[model samples]
Target: MVSMRSALRTAPALAALLLVLTGCGDSGPAAYGTDDRTITVDHGEKFTLKVPANPELGQNWYLASPRADAGVLKYRGDREDTGDGDGTQFFDFTALSRGKATVKLLFCPYGRCHSADEVASKPVPTATGTPKDSDQEAAYYLYTITVR
Candidate 1:
């Protein structure tokens, strides 16, 4: 029902809008998880480690400091998203130099989280050691990162 002139006028505008929308997406840094035990990145590149954590249920993930080599990787910060009792936690990092670094995360499962001060007081728990003893539900997630 439209005239040729009207269709022609809208065609260019629609194409421009489509091009703009295509270029608006944000491709963030590389993301990893427990399954990705080994990772590599270029110097100065940024990356994040995504873990599942629902603080409302006492599921916590802490960056195990003194584990990763600071000279190679710099810990930036952390962020989280909560929804439907299934939340996600993010640990940000930047590749500082060309070397190898190991990142360790201490996971405190539901009903068993420790304070910052208490993290060092107790021995590091193995990933398989979840609930190994009375009321203590602690585990570790380990990863090796190589920077180039």
Candidate 2:
């Protein structure tokens, strides 16, 4: 009877502790995928630009080089997660210095993008270039970032 009383008294505390622990993990960098036009971060900070992709339907993404200032930011790489059926592609980057840079994300649907080499061959987009929305056939998203 004494042991049962102790367990019952501590059960709620244990449950709360477990809940806090479960939420602790590498949640990755802050995402700037929404309506924010400018992303600001501290020097040496990391951030991710996540976009939807479904390669089964020929939906893909590619990072456009020369669009971003390498002196300000470093392009870490790209990745994909299709486990949830709704595919997602992410571009990881780290702020290198205190300056402004623009990251160009290209969306290619229906296999319009032949290969990475082809995308690489495309000329760099001018700073004033307009980025098309993803719903269109080929869309370009320009993200301006400032690191302090």
Each prediction's RMSD over C-alphas, in Å, is: 4.7, 4.3
How far does residue 58 in candidate 1 sit from its true spot (Å)?
0.7
lDDT of 2: 0.76
State residue 113's C-alpha deviation in candidate 2, in Å: 1.6
Count clashes in each candidate, considering only residues at least 3 apart in sequence or on different chains.
0, 0
Clashing pairs in 2: none
Listed in order, each prediction's TM-score against the native is 0.74, 0.70
Candidate 2 local Cα displacement, residue 46, angstroms = 0.8
- Overlapping backbone residue pairs in candidate 1 total 0
Query: Which whole-number lDDT from 0 to 100 does residue 18 have in model 2?
Result: 89
lDDT of 1: 0.79
Residue range 10-92, candidate 2, lDDT tens digits: 99999989888888665879887635547899999999988778888787878865558889988988889986677888889
